[model samples]
Target chain A: MATAKDRAQAKAGSGLNDDIGEQKRLELYRTQVVLREAEQRAYDLFLQNLVKGTSHLSLGQEAVAAGFAGAMKPGDLSFCTYRGHAHTLARGVPVEKVLGELMQRDNGLMRGKGGSMHLTSVDHGVMGSYAIIGAHLPIACGAAWRAQYKGDKDVSVCFFGDGTTNIGAFHEALNFAAVWKLPVIFVCENNLYMEYTPIGDVTAVPQPAADRASAYGLERILIDGNDADVVYRAAQIAFDKARAGEGPSLIECLTYRQSGHSRADPAKYRPEGELDRWKLRDPIKIYRERLLQFGVAERVIADIDAQVRKVVDDATEACKAAPPPPLDIIATDVYADGGWAWRN
Target chain B: MAELTYRDAVIRGIAQEMSRDPDVVFLGEDVAKAGGVFKATVGLYEQFGPLRVRDTPISEQAILGAAMGAAMTGLKPIAEIMFSDFFAVCFDYIANEFPKSRYMSNGQVKCPLVVRTGNGAGSRFGAQHSQSVENWCMMIPGLKVVAPSNPRDVIGLLAASVRDPDPVIFLEHKSLYPTKGEVPDGEIVDTLGTAKVLRSGKDATICALALMVPRALEAAEKLKAKHGIDCEVVDVRSLVPLDTQTILGSVARTHRLFTVEENPRLCGWGAEIVSIVADEAFYDLDGPPVRITTPHIPLPAADILEDIVLPTPDRIAETVRRSLQS
Candidate 1:
């Protein structure tokens, strides 16, 4: 019996070709490996300390973050779900602050008040990532609509899990986003589970999650989420389209989570051969394989790895040594101005 | 300065703010072509265009949630809930998100939103329409509640509210809108969070907000001529960030306190004032703090029963005279 990869090789060596430009496509593919390595390192750190809260590892889902954040311009806004560490890190919110936030330190994003669920930075336009599954969609629509009202050239993105597709807010927000033609991208990381329950069990409709996007009249695309190049090109097309006065886009990235749901559970229900099957599509392994074939040296990869590790270490030490915000900070900024906090 | 009615003053203030700040947008039911039921937002749609002066969906929750979002993202939004009663639908947004966003965000953002709604039971519009629940907003932190009575106070108070950094719940009395008074339309904006000692007398100080201010004034006049009581009428303009100093000062001087309100006796804004006075100025009191408020029942559909349910000038004067004696 011929294997799938072996039979395709025997049929044609060049006919089923890679339909992409060399440099841009190769650069994005390379980023997939970097992100995968970075996330793996982050996961290794988690395993080392037995870090608290759920880390929704972007093992297979790394392409969505790299593609969207890679194309994101300054002043662009994005809000994600509770499993948003990858999203936050992709948006350039420092890994230390993201980790510090996860650790519930005051110096972290949301000043430790918003832990694993709520990650926010208004300055960078990572508006908020909430634990409440569907709440941020309304918030994203509100912000994007306001930007349009002000004639500001800002686009927003909302990230949700495959589970959130069943939520009423998902339907309402998508409709609202389309009706207003708001500059928003609805990125669904369909890792095939809404926590423990399989996505098929919950959602009536399937595929692309973007298949439902047509009902809202938004542009929809389904890509190999494990392929960073495909995700980046698709995301770039959507981003520019939205910025050019078109409406929202629903891009469903089909991927799988390699870790347990959070710090808890073995994710045993993830089917018997599923993990090993998906592991073959590992984003980091594919990139290294491509780069080596492209004549990129192993020494360069080693250097890049060293550079990222040093940065992560410096960030970890800095955050560990930093003091938590004072208790008086709790009373400040309730109204964004003045003594109207609890004083009023 | 133009001598304007309370209604005209608020209209002019909104017009001026809407003109100066492009981000200063207005949203309410029937506010666009209908120009608001009270006509306070009259002529705004033409001046600012439909986008800025929007006619939102009838859902109060959606209106407020949208306003909360708009304000959070830099637009200075003033959303109108037709009557104070409708605000019940939006209390959670106000209580949870609007009040807590800034704190949770670590002072990184502020919701500079103004929820312009009115309270009072004068219209005989039945229970649903005639609810004076401004005190209900007092429960939320990070909200500024201001109730302006007269044309001048309305003009100044609204301007102050428009410019305030925090979320403000500006309560305009329906009954006082038609009442004519000398309002200043000038470079000067009225000070925020300060109580106006509208009338100064010695026997006792009467504290009132919004519609009750006029009623309290009428009662004070009656006390002066008929009962031989020198009544001081203090308009507690801004309910939150309340001018406690002025209230305590007046209470300390007169050694007597009486509060008048259109809201029910239980947990009314007047009760909050009386409680503050009791806690802070207990030793200064010559007599106990007296509250003259509407009964617990909702405002009735019939004019006679509605009047009976709410506190009239006569009732306020009776309460004041009793406080003076006992």
Candidate 2:
């Protein structure tokens, strides 16, 4: 019996074989594996009491993050929500630095100030990840506005969850972005849940992206978030439109989070058999099988898996050995000029 | 120096910074074709064109959020929220996003943002639009709050605010927009968090901000001529980094301290000033500090009732005389 993956490949990858060749498939497969392993390692460290605070893992939502972040230009900006580990890693931040930041070490990306929820790298065009849901939407529009103001061809991509569409900032950001025709793409990774409650329970509209974005006069598209190629194609179309000065587009990727919302959440509210069902369609498993069918040698897949394991292991070891940030420097980064301090 | 209205001074200050730095951009409702409700941003849209001087939607959340976003991404954005009271709608961005972004990112990003708004209560805009909520922002640690009284100071403070490497809430009183004064045409950049002594006297120290600065000077004149009490008036232009040295110096010389503002008396900027004096300059003060502020009530639309509700020169003079008696 042909599975859903086979049917999706037949329809999405038919004779239009120009989608992506064997080499690109292997690259995407490697990136997806690296992100999966790194996230798992980070979780293991958290369980060991090395990573401070809570961690929001994108366990099963790797396809959307990889597709969107990989499609961006080097100068283009990408903003993420608290479930941002996969997004930041996909933006080319080194595994060691990400682990270091998660551990709050001196050599972290933000010098130990920002933990897992606030990871950012300006050099990689990865704007800071916001802890507040939907708050980063307008900020992403601002970056796009800056790009438009300077007549630059760069586009900004904002990655948020299904829960964000219900907030006022989401509406305001879409309205302003459409009015100005700013170069931005808003990607809604609909993982079916807003923390604990199902998205359908909290959201007013059934199709959040199409329903909300159409009102703002923005071009909206819904795609299968579990399929990397589908997300990549949708993102390319949106990015091309934005670069052509056609304003912003909304791409809603329908995916699911395999893990709980945060480290502390057990997600016992998940209905029976839901986890087992999603585990069968795990993005890594499906993509790995697809890469094999695409004629990539088994040795290449094995080599990639080994390489990812070594990278995650070494990065975790380094982060654990790193020291915490100095106490004297605690009050230094509050302001740019060093005037403001935490007064007693 | 050239004669320019307070509104034009704001325009000139912004225009000058816009011309000097390519990264400076302006965006707000009615800022482009409408030239701002108070005309403070007049002629800017025409001078810099649409890309630089943008007319945004009436979403204070997006306006302020975009300012912080653009500021972090190598742009100095000056966003105008039409009225100070409207800040309540977007206080989350001001209180959380803009001020904490730099700190949260561990100094990797700089938010050189200036949110210019028309403040104060003389226009009969009523309670919804007439509240002086600058004190609400003063409690936040990462933001700089400044309110300028005259055209000259507006020019200097606006320029400095644009150049500062942080977020500044620039307050311009609605009534002072059309008032004309001599302003310098050349660069007139003033330091942030500094106070200027408008009048020098030896008997009592009068500290005020925004529109109250002029009323404080008037009260000082009446106190000296009619009551034989010499009062020194200090315009605390900047509120966040309170200039304790200048304020303490004036208190040491005059031995008496009095604060005047148009906001409600409870938990206003005056309260912060009085507490600071009592904490740091207690020994230098000869008498207990006095604060003359509006009573704890919403501003009314009627001019007669509003006049009685807000502070006035007579009330300031009477407060000074009463304080001198102690």
Candidate topping lDDT: 2
Q: What tens digits encode model 2's per-residue C-alpha lDDT throughout B1-326?
A: 78998899899899989999989999999999998888788899999998899998889889998888888888999999999999999998888888888877888878889999999999888998888888888888788899999999998999999998889999999988888898765878888888999999999999999989989999999998999999999999998767877888899899999999899978898888888789988998888999999999999999998889888999999999987885
- Model 1 bad stretches (over 4 Å): A1-60, A131-133, A161-176, A190-226, A252-306, A335-344, B1-5, B59-62, B65-69, B83-92, B118-120, B123-129, B264-267, B294-306
Looking at model 2, the pairs that clash are none
Using TM-score as the measure, the top candidate is: 2
Tens-digit per-residue lDDT, A32-84, candidate 1: 54455555655665676634455666667776787777778888888888777
TM-score of each model, paired residue for residue: 0.83, 0.96
- Report lDDT per candidate: 0.75, 0.86
RMSD of each: 5.2, 2.8
Query: Which pairs of residues clash in candidate 1, taking residues 3 or more apart in a chain or in different chains?
Result: A54-A262
> What's the TM for model 2?
0.96
RMSD of 2: 2.8
